[model samples]
Target: MRAAIANYWWGSSTDNRHIHWMRWGRLTAAKCQGGMGFRNLRHFNVAMLGKQGWRLMSRPESLCARVLKGRYFHDSDFMECTRKKHASHTWRAILAGREVLGQGLIKRIIGDGSLTNIWRDRWLPQHFNGRPITPLADQYVTRVADLITASGQWNEDLVRQVFFLVDAEAILRTPIRGRGDDIWAWELEKHGMYSVRSAYRLLENQRLH
Candidate 1:
């Protein structure tokens, strides 16, 4: 398919012979970066597969998501799940796509903060590294819920004391008004939802950089 596409791109439809001015790779680069912006087929496939993996993360309530989770990662989240020796082709393909998710996957703090670890999960949207810059305090907090007050607000005094000033401020700024589960989201999009378009762009940018 690639050969046929390349042939049609630079040569006559009736004949294969033509003067190729640029390589297929350059043609696949972004148009703004001085290339034709053609989609790299392999990268696009991975991005699409990544979308499936992302759905498995974001839509745990869906039938497909639940079934896959039961079969694969019943105890842990998709990101932490490992390969099984008897894993199906579908599972392996989804895992391949999931690999593309990488560090871009971040948890949005929504309802109760039980699922998000205070020291580990990437929940701080404003912070550069996503996780808190605060050093772990001794046994005072483990989950994000520990940092929340009884009124569902941040434990202001504890937050200020336990975290560095920077992290304290970031934590204080995070809104936890919604009564939903803490869920994983793609950090690249404003709505925090994953799309093949965004995934493809992310994959392409990674290739370029």
Candidate 2:
């Protein structure tokens, strides 16, 4: 379908063996990059599917998410779920673009911290190395709340025991807001909300690199 659209825009016809004055790849580049601002249909499709996956991850209470989960990923986090054999085409399409959604998604920690897992989540502040502190942190310290006190403050001693010195320091410096639930944020946007524009931009940057 995308190929057909590209061919039509480039003036290719069934009867003529004419030259394509400009190749499809060049013509599809963004305007700022010196081509027609035509959206790459393949990437756009994946990105749109990614937005649905994002909704499933962040809005599990929605009817669509619940139905998918009951059928496909009952025991795993949406991001960690895998496609099973004999799945519907719709399920497969959403799974295909899951990685694009994961890359730009950020989990913000707040309140009780029960939903944020300490060792598994990316909530730790980044260091100079560009990696979160202690990517190899102990698996024993599972939930982020495990490192916090009943009084709603960090448990400094437990954090030191579970994480490396540097990571422990970083964790101690992190604060949890007292009244709200943990939330997911789209790191690409200022308001921390997901947008198709941000998803496309992320996909474009990734393709370039």
Global lDDT of each model? 0.84, 0.75
- Candidate 1 segments whose C-alpha is farther than 4 A from its true place: 12-15, 135-140
**Candidate 2: regions farther than 4 A off:** 125-140, 155-175
lDDT of 2 by residue, 1-209 (tens): 76676667767778854556776667768878887877777778888998888889778899999999999999998888888999999999999787677677666777788888665556754443222466563367677877778899888888777677887777777668677888877767878777888788777777767
Screening candidate 1 with a backbone cut-off below 3 angstroms (N, C-alpha, C), the clashing residue pairs are none
Clashes per model (N, Cα, C within 3 A) = 0, 0
Summing lDDT over every window of 10 consecutive residues in candidate 1, give the lowest-scoring window.
Answer: 11-20
lDDT of 1 by residue, 1-209 (tens): 77778888897476548877889899998888888888899889888898898888777799999999999999988888998999999999999987678656777778779889877788888587788876665657889989887678888999887888999899999889678788888888898887788888878887888
